[model samples]
Target chain A: MERSTIDLWVGIFVALGVAALLGLAMKVGNLTTSNIGATYTVTANFENIGGLKPRAPVKSAGVVVGRVSEIKFDATTFEAVVSLSVDKRYVFPKDTFASIFTAGLLGEQYIGLEAGGDDAKLQNGDKIIKTQDAVVLEKMISQFLYNKAAETPKAPETSGSTSSVVDALGANPLDNTTVNTTINTLDNKGKTDIAQPVAP
Target chain B: MIRSKLLTSAIRTLRNIGSRFTERIWRMGAGARLFGLIVVSSGECLRRPRLVVREVYFTGVMSLIIILVSAFFVGMVLGLQGYNTLQTYGSSEAIGVLVALSLVRELGPVITALLFAGRAGTAITAEIGLMKATEQLSAMEMMAVSPIARVLAPRFWAGVIAMPILAALFCMVGVLGGYLVAVPLIGVDAGAFWSQMQASVDWQHDILNGMFKSVVFGVACTIIAIFEGYDAPPTAEGVSRATTRTVVTSSLVVLGLDFILTSFMINI
Candidate 1:
């Protein structure tokens, strides 16, 4: 090929490489959506951010409007500080609430902003006072297990006749002895199970 | 008696293979010295820019079509596999994440390197080996021109640069192929596919690490091919032997390096 033609092909090759890089960055990697037109930065603090990394999409009403720009830990508050950039086109009220949501249940996490009905508009460097942290599945599972185990001790309180019935029925849903007592006493088991609220 | 004889023959064959592998490693070490010399002489490439362009046009531009086509097929297969497996979990939407991760992180670089070794690496060795067999390198040396600077360095740099670019293109094409299969054929939601993919794949971790692997493979493959060609005995049989060695050895090196690089990049 001629040198000029080679040069043109080389340019095309470089452009293709750059396009690939951009695709990887934008389509495969949720890099900041800041450069589309204009954007404003806002900060939020959360107690926990489970696997919520930078470049995670910031969605509002199930629509992506921005991205998480930076994440840092504040020693004084002991909270994870996340900076988000929202597009200028999509405006949010001052009382907008932000929560971390997981995509596809087990997939990557992103921030979901719930719009509030407020007259004031959130501007640059605006700090969102209301923020919810990422819900850790492991912690939730552990809590569930602990609650189950704790309810077992309350089961011994079931055999105290009416008082036991009251304690077991009133206190925990896991203890099934209360239902047995009701079955024995009321002679109408199905009605009792329906009448008593299962305390969990 | 026959069992013992068979065992002894097996042991002998294994020993011979082991010894040959060690001998190849020794030759590779010697060849690596040529790599060092080529690195030092690469400044000559900038001075003779046309030579680099020619070599790049040959190795990189020539290999582009095959690289793109193979990557597309590989990606389509990945999409089908991911869809079938993920549909069992009721989360076929994550297909884009699966396809992108597989292509960008591992398949793109490794497969591209293997294809490049077969295509460009063999050609470089054959071309240089033929030149050596014809006493062209000798004539250049006799004319007080350094063959390493004039011939090997340009081609070496070209291959090295071409590799990462080709691998990147392969990944891009692979993503499109995946999109075609996942969105239309499998009936996955287009929004979820791209959104999940974008959320999951890290720009620094997956994409950069893949590019880094391709660059290393590129350097290793091109160096091995050129060295084998330059060191081949001046004969037709010797040139063919060198070309074969280049393919096998470059492939082995690329795979081995890939393993080492993966362990370091992923684990650490």
Candidate 2:
């Protein structure tokens, strides 16, 4: 090839390389969005993030509406604070629940936003009050094994109340004033230690 | 008596072959030596951009057509195979995910490097082997210049840079080829194909990792090719044997490295 021909070919080669990389970033990487649009940030704190990482997809009804921009640990609160940058096109309700979900049974984790019936729109920098942690397979398996081992074949309690088992599960006296107040309404509130782990 | 004599000869031949193999193993090159060479050549790479660019044009641009054509065919094959399998599950649209994941995570880098080894890598080995045979490298040494810097570094570095770029091109073209087969031939919805891929693939994890894998393959193939050529006995037969060695050795190394790299990139 001549000098100009070589240069042109080289240019084309470099361009194709870049195009392929961008194509990869777009098609196979879920990096299509430049994050350079009319977007707002909202925070959600979870007890455990599991394998969730920054820039993991934030999906609503399985549609990617945003990205997880940041993940940080709050030492005092003992929670994972995740900041999501949602597009302006999708406005979420105030009572929206954000849950960390695995892509499959044991895949990369992402944030799944479940919109609530509330009419109020979440504003920038607003915090999502209700959040669920990741369904860690390891923890669930271990808990299952522990529960199986602890099944003692004891006779039914005299109260005939599931709360009787809850009382035996070592219900925290301080838990009533803290997180997961919804669990307290159920008679078997103490059974939630295996379901929803308390922050250590 | 005849059977016993034949068995003894066979055993002697086996011992001879075993000793030769052991000798080759004992003469294996050191990592410290390769590292030193890379350090020297990498510095030369930094000093001379024009030389590197020229070599890249030769090594990379020349292989474009073969890479594209092969990748397109491979992608088409993947589309057909993946569609056939997934259609049984009533999820043909997810063929996009299958094709993209296979190409980005495995096939694209591995196949492109394999092709590159056959094409530019052997060419590089032969060219350097010929130079060594003709005493061009020796002539450069006589002129008080380092042939390692002038002759070897730029070409070696160019091969390293070009491999990843070529692999990327292969991936892009392959995805298009897959789309063409899936959408037009198989009647898969384009939206589902792309959307499913978008939802599942991770940029930093899948795509970038594939690129990194290609870069590493490039360095390995080029080093093997150049080293074999430079070390070849200075003759026409030597050059030819060196070229053959470059192709076979690099192919095996690429496969082995691919397994190691895949283990690191993916979780079981």
CAPRI category for model 2: medium
List the lowest-lDDT window of 10 residues for candidate 1 chain A: A157-166
Residue-level lDDT tens digits of model 1 in B1-268: 9999999999999999999999878886889799999999888899878888878888998898999999899989999999899999988998999999999988999899999989999999999999988889899999999999999999999998899999998998999999999999978999999887976787787889999999999999999899999888888999899989888888888889999999998742
User: For model 2, what is the alpha-carbon lDDT of residue A151?
Assistant: 62
- Pairs with steric clashes in candidate 2: none
lDDT for each residue of candidate 1 in A1-200, tens digit (9 for 90 to 100): 34578877776776887888787777777564324467899999999999998878899888879889899999999999999988889989999999999987787799999999999999999999999889999899767655655565645634445564345435555458977886678777667889899899
Interface RMSD of each: 1.4, 1.3
DockQ (C-alpha) of model 2? 0.50
The complex in candidate 1 yields a DockQ of 0.46
Q: Cα RMSDs of all predictions?
A: 8.2, 12.7
**TM-score result, candidate 2:** 0.70
Candidate 1 lDDT for residue B228: 90
Which prediction has the highest DockQ against the true structure? 2
Model 1 has fnat of: 0.61
Candidate 2 lDDT, B143-238, residue by residue in tens: 987787877888888888899999998988898999999999889998888988876777878888998999999988988888888878898888
Badly placed stretches (over 4 Å) of model 1 are A1-48, A54-101, A111-133, A138-200, B1-29, B199-205, B260-268
